[model samples]
Each structure stands twice: as structure tokens, then as C-alpha cells.
Target: LVDHKQTALPALIEQLDSEERDHPIRKLAFTLRAIGDQRAVPVLIRAFPKTLLPASSDYGIKIEDPELKRWIAKHDLGKGRSIFSYLRAFREVVGALQQLTGQNFGEMELFGVNLANTESQRHLQREQFHQIAQHWAHWWEANQESHGVDPAYAKARVLMAGKKQGQLLDKDMRETAAE
Candidate 1:
């Protein structure tokens, strides 16, 4: 059996099925924290934020951990319950992904993101994502391996484009506007 400890993290990520990423190995790695092997550190770091150990007997991660009380007593994060540390942990994921991928991964929009108005998010109401999508086609042209990418979202984009192009069908309106 090949020892995964010696394997490159990128290769391990490519090899493991998504389920394997969530189970025993991920738990063990997080429990150990700094897994010492630099090659595996990237993979371990990616898993850390998501590894939800048994928070309490009641079992609801959204409810906050027991250590949270101790942290409040210390006043390190100020009063009133807020998920600041959780938000900060997310930045680590972004930082690591940026290091691994070069260029910012923040610009990329995954197909399955949760948003009330995905159309607006992808095009209309303006998120950082619209510019990313504008550039996505070009990125795809350059990288064939990205074919697994989700379908293009364009309803809001179409609306935004029409708005920008002048919301008038009249030839005179178009001509005058062009000038």
C-alpha cells in the first residue's frame, strides 16, 4: 500500500472520491492539526474549517461550541454572539487556494452557489461574480480541463446588456444616443 503521507496533496485530491474527502482521513488530519508533512498541509488546511466535531450532546453546529463560553469570558472577541472567528477561518481557505492556484480564486463562481436571486448575482444586481463570468469564457478557452464547469447563467446578463445598450428600439433613439 502506498503511504499517502508521502503523496503530493494535489495528486491525493485528484485521487480521492468526494466522500473520502469528508470521512475518516479528514477527521484524523484535523484532530492532529499541523500534520507536519508540508505536502499534506495544503489538503489538511482546506479540510479544517469544515470539520465539525461533536460540538455538544444536543448536536447542532449552528448552536456554537462549549468553548465559545470560555472565549466570551476572555473577552478576546467582544460581547454579543457573532460568528467572527468563523468568517476569519473562511479567509484562510481563500488564502490557501490563492497560493495554490496563483491569481485569486475569489473571482471564480461555482455553478451551485446558494443565492436568492442567482440571476441577479450572476449578472444584474452586480456582484464581483459578473466580471468573473465575463472573463470565464476566455478562461475556458485557455483551459480545457475546466469543461466540468456548470452551465452559463445569462438571464440577468441579457437584461444588463440590454440596459447598457440603451433600452430603446427606435432607430432615431438609438442613433441620437450613439452620438
Candidate 2:
């Protein structure tokens, strides 16, 4: 389904947007990466912010005790984990962008930082995320029109053909060895 980027790409983007679940969104982002379409860049960028938020189910839990709620919020128990996941997801998106555009804007390093270890680290990581996202957005806006299409799409076809030829050669070799 991912290879058929003409249709599958847009559908996946819609799913990424509409689905509140992090798992589905992460799957869609990886699918888009596998598709290797330059068109997926913008969609991935838009979905980046969504990854930072805790799942809808997290909010649905009814906390009866105000003190507990305050403690949870203050310590960022669930929220910290969600942010960690978001950073990982954001890294994948940035990776896809780098692969598609052949540009490294240092986003991978920014996203890879271990922010969950300490509160100060988390603050720094959040600031870095904002900076990286802004940089990518600005870069995309400037160069979106210049990128014609996915270069990997053409390369993938070539690689597949090579693989088929290699398989045939291997089979012939096996037959010769048997004879």
C-alpha cells in the first residue's frame, strides 16, 4: 500500500491527521518514509506537533483526587513519557526528510537527546525541538518547489530489477552445481 504513493500517500496523511492514537500515527509516518515520496514531507511536519501530546485515553482517566492530579501534572508522569515518544517519532520524521532531500539540518541530534532523565534536560530538549521544527519548516518553504520528485522511487525500481537478476543467477548456479 505504501508503494502506491499516488493514492496511499494522501490516505495515510489523512489517517495521521485524524487518528489521535500515537501508534497509528507512528505507523503512518513510517509508512510514508518507506514510500520515499517527497510529498510526504509536509504531512509529516504537520503531524510532528500531534506526537507531543498524550493520547486521548490518557485524558479520559477520571482523577478524583485533586492532590494526585496536581502531583502527576507537576512531575509530568505520563506527559514525560509521551514527550519521549514524540521525540523518537520526530526523529523518524526528520530522518525521512533527510533521506528525501539529502539535507542534514542537525535535527536528528536534537531529537536524540535524552530529555527524560532530568527536568532541566527536558526543558532544553523542548526548546531544541521548537528550533529544529522551525528550521525545517522554513527550509521546506524555501525549497519545496525545487524538489521535483522522489529520487528513490526510480532507484527502487532499478534495485528490484538487480535483485531479480541476482536471484536468477543464484538459481542457475545451484542447478549447475547439482548437475
Question: Which prediction has the highest TM-score against the true structure?
Answer: 2
For model 1, the run of ten residues with the poorest summed lDDT: 153-162
Task: Give candidate 2 regions above 4 Å deviation.
Answer: 19-21, 50-87, 114-124, 149-179
RMSD for all candidates, in order, please. Answer: 15.1, 18.5
How well does model 2 score by local distance difference test?
Answer: 0.53
Q: Write the per-residue lDDT of candidate 1 for residues 1-179, one digit (tens) a residue.
A: 12343344344533321222234443334222222233333343333223222221211123266675554323222225443222222223333333333445343243223223446543432333233333322333344233332232111111122243334223432332344
**Which candidate gets the maximum lDDT versus the true structure?**
2
Error of 2 at 27 (Å): 1.3
Residue pairs in candidate 2 whose N, alpha carbon or C atoms collide under 3 angstroms: none
65-146 per-residue lDDT for model 2 (tens digits): 7775664333332343322222245555665667667888766564434435566755655555555555555566567768
